[model samples]
Target chain A: MWQLFTQNWQDFLTGFWHTILSSIIALVFSFILGSGFAILETNPNKFWRGVAKVYVEIFRNIPLLVVTMFFYLVLPKVLPAMNGFTAGTIGLTLYTSAFIAETVRSGLQSVGTGQMEGCLANGLSYWQAMKNVILPQALKITIPPLGNQFINLIKNSSVLAFVAGMDLMYQGDVIASNTFQTIPTYIIVGIFYLILTLPLSYYMQYLEKKLA
Target chain B: MAIIDFKHVDKFYGGFHVLKDINFRVNGGEVVVIVGPSGSGKSTLIRTINGLERINDGSLIVDGKDMTDKSTNFNELRRDVGMVFQHFNLYANKTVLENIMLAPRIVLHRPEEENHKEAMRLLEEVNLVEKANSYPHQLSGGQQQRIAIARSLAMKPKVILFDEPTSALDPEMIQDVLDVMKLVAQEGITMVVVTHEMGFAREVGTRVVFLADGEILEDSDPKSFFDHPQTKRARQFLSKVISH
Candidate 1:
């Protein structure tokens, strides 16, 4: 295992780039979709809120692989030329967005009732209150849970390999197949994931402290 | 013309009948103190002025705007009618100073320099200038309540409402908050307060209104309210609270 990492150092370094790319893409898209869904879930109109609820349930209940496979295999048939990477990235975004919606919804709810009343009493409109006063406080309350979701999201990105996506895990499978060094190649992959997650975890901890 | 009026108001929380046929008038710069037992709708009555609580049936006119009208702009009414809650509902995310500055900046659209200066002055009035940068959690109940008062005053409203402002404070801290409010009353800003503090009522209030079981039991001057004892409920309540 030790020798494998030493020998495959260059390949391991290259894999880091692929892992980072998938994570960055997933993070940006998921946050956008997730925040949108969270707002929809909390909408005063029952119909819009119900629509958000259905979207969350549908995406969250299905396995990420199944969703990715459907996209990778089925979407191309429906609309020509959609590749594995596109399918996997889109799948990861949708799946992670469901969880992110849950996180943010709870965050918004955790803000006390008085905060809203206080804002209203001070003559701020509802949207103004939510955006300026409530969200800042809710975002603070949500950091630890949000950080956990982000780490889980990075690990979940490995599922991209099963769909023949050219992610870090796919590269690891190729290296192991060619070299017959399964344990070492996987061990290298595990270390690559550790390298990615540790710094992310630390950064989140730093934010928690700073916000505290 | 009366600055605030609640005429034949009846409020019901699902047949509970919270405030029955409430009639009161507060002229410009008159300080009215409402004293009552728990669940007597004193808070509800004041909240209706800013449309925080809808009266089931009544005409609530404040600064000439009829609150009963569905077309009335509640947010606009609230801009000119500020309320300090019993819980000292200062925005927890904001510092004491931000709590004071926010309304003036957003609602009034005042310049930043003027807002800051006014907030500083209000904080000084509340004796919270030293704690301006602190969060609400960092302050005691009395300090938080005082900050809440300053936040309401920042709007420069036509009238201010207090719903048991000092009810949640400690015994030692209650007098300080009342002192700030007494000063505010002295400044002749139209004020309506719901409180059990009969002493403060006697000292600062121009009129004293007693409520029981969601109905006005008595509405009179504080001197007559305490000395004369007009109603069975008001007399019993005053004796109970004052003896304690």
Candidate 2:
């Protein structure tokens, strides 16, 4: 493993950076999409509520690999062909968003009804009450569960490897097959994944403590 | 001139009737105290005034706007009406000063300096000047309730609703909240308070409305209602709550 690390360090670094980029992009887009859908799920309008329900169920029930494959294989037929990284990241964003939506929606519901009523009776529009008063309070309750989603998102980004996305896992597979050092190559890949995830998990704990 | 007029109003929660054939008028500067037993719909009745609880039947006019009309903007109407809840629902995320200033600034678009001055003045008025930067969870129940009242007053609402404001307080803290309410009453903001404090009803209320089983049982001057409760139900209610 030591000899392999020294020989292929540049290749390993490229894959590690790609994995981090994919996770960050997916993490950001999923958060926005998830929060928006969660708000829609709670909307008073029936049409919007139905749309949110359908979208969440579709992505949440399907496997992440299948979702990513569909984007990689099928999406290119209709839209312009996207490389493995783009397809995997887009798929990861939509899939992770479903779980995040549920987390945020439950958080929103947990906030006492009186918060909305107080703002309403105090003379604010419904959206104003939601934006200024209710959402901020819900965000505190959402931090822990939302943190879990983010950690899961980084791990799931490894699906990019199956589609030849040149992420950490893909590099591990290539090096193991070529050098026939499967054990050491995969071990290095696992360590790189830990590098991405452990910091996030600890940062979430810090945020939870500070908010509390 | 009537500030709130409920004409033949009927509200039902599916099969259960909440407000039944309610016809009443709250005139300008009149503090109407609604006293009732649990599940008798005093909260439901007061909620209808601000369109928080919609009526299933009849025209409910508040400040000349008929709530029954589909186009009547409740949000716009709420700018002139305010409410204090039993739980004292101060925005948990904001400081005490932000709790009082937010609605006036966002909804009314009050200038920033004027909004800050008004919020601080209202905090001083509520005797919570020292708690301006503290969050809602930091305050005692009575103190939170006083801040809620101040938050309502900051809107300069023409009418205010009190839905059991003192009921949630510690016995020792109830007097402080009642004192703040009495001060509000003195300012002649039309108020409809649902409370069991007979002493407050007698001293601060211009009229007493007795309700039972979602119907108005008695409406009279505080003296007549307390001294000579016309209905047997009102007499029984007064006996149960007013021990002193």
Candidate 3:
């Protein structure tokens, strides 16, 4: 098992790099999209609120694989086909954003209306009130949930492996098949994931305690 | 000239009428106290001045601008109108000084040094200079309300509205909040206060507007409205409120 890791180190490294890239890209875009939808969910306009509600329900309820498969298999019919990495990242981003939207929306709603009223009455515009006053307070309440969603996104990025996206799990599959070291290769993949998520999980726990 | 005018205004929440044909005007520099029983629309009436609540029918003018007009920028009007809620509603994430400085910095675009200087002055005005660096959660209810007052004053708003400002405070804390309010009244800023504090009303209020069941039962000087209320609703309200 040790020799297998040493020999297949380059493949593992490639997978790790791809996984990191996908997670980072998905994390950034999902946060922006989720936060945007969250704001729209809280918007006073009924139509926009409806749109947000539909988007959140659709993406959140759908299976992650189905969403990724749609992009990989279905999207090619209409638009130029994207590579597996692109399709996987987009699906993960959209799927994770639904949960993030729910998390952020709850946080936004939890902030007492008084805070927004106070900011508005103090001459701040709606956007200014949200940006400067409401979002900051909401963010404090959302940190723990958002942290969980981020970790989930990193784990879910493994969905990329199913589509030949060359993530850590994909490389593990390649090595296990070639070398027949299935158990050890899978163990190493699990360990690699722990390296990324464990510290984050601990950091979020610490934050929750501090805020509490 | 009237700074806030409500001309036959009507407001409803679904089928429930909240403010019925409200016809009243608040002139510049006058302190108007609006007192009523619960659901009497005291808060709603004052809120309409800043476009916080929309009037279903009729014209409303504030600070030489017609609020009911769709083209009117409510945010610009808000710069001239400030409000202190029953709850302090200070930004929990911001320090006390930041609470005061945020608007002038972001909204009014006041330079940092000038804004900081003004914030310290307002903190002095609220007698909370020492607590400038403290967060809202760190302050007592009275202190937080005082800082909220300082935050509104930072905008130099032409009119300030208080919606049952002390109703949410502890009995002991109420007096401190009222004292700061008195200081604000002394500055000759136009104020519309919805308070149950009769003593503050009798003392600082130039005019008293009595509301009951969404109607202006009486609008008179504080002395007559207190001593010789015009309508039976006003009389009954005063009796019920004063006895308790």
How much is A85 displaced in model 3, in angstroms? 1.2
Q: At residue A203, what lDDT does model 2 achieve?
A: 96
Q: Between candidates 1 and 3, which one is better according to TM-score?
A: 3
Given candidate 2, what's the lDDT at residue B180? 95
Q: What is the DockQ of each candidate?
A: 0.72, 0.87, 0.84
For every candidate structure, what is the RMSD over all alpha carbons to the true structure, in angstroms?
2.6, 1.3, 1.3
TM-score for candidate 3, please give it: 0.97
In model 1, the runs with Cα more than 4 Å from the true position are: A1-15, A39-48, A75-81, A205-212, B68-70
List model 2 lDDT by residue over B1-244, tens digit each.
7999999999999999988999999999999999989999999999999999889998899999999998999999999999999999999999999999999899899999999999999888889999999999999999999999999999999999999999998999999999999999899899999998889999999999999999999999999999999999988888899876
Weakest 10 consecutive residues of candidate 2 chain B by summed lDDT: B235-244
Instruction: For each candidate, give its TM-score against the true structure.
Output: 0.91, 0.97, 0.97
Give the docking tier of candidate 1: medium
Backbone clash numbers for all candidates listed: 0, 0, 0
Mind giving the per-residue lDDT tens digits that candidate 3 earns over A1-212? Answer: 77878999999989998999999999999999999999999999899999999999999999999999999999999999999999999999999999999999999999999899988999899999999988888889999999999999999999998888999999999999999999999998988899889999999999999998
Q: What residue runs in model 3 are displaced by over 4 Å at the alpha carbon?
A: none
Cα deviation in Å at residue B64, candidate 1? 3.5
Report the poorest 10 consecutive residues by lDDT, candidate 3 chain A: A1-10
Error of 1 at B89 (Å): 1.8
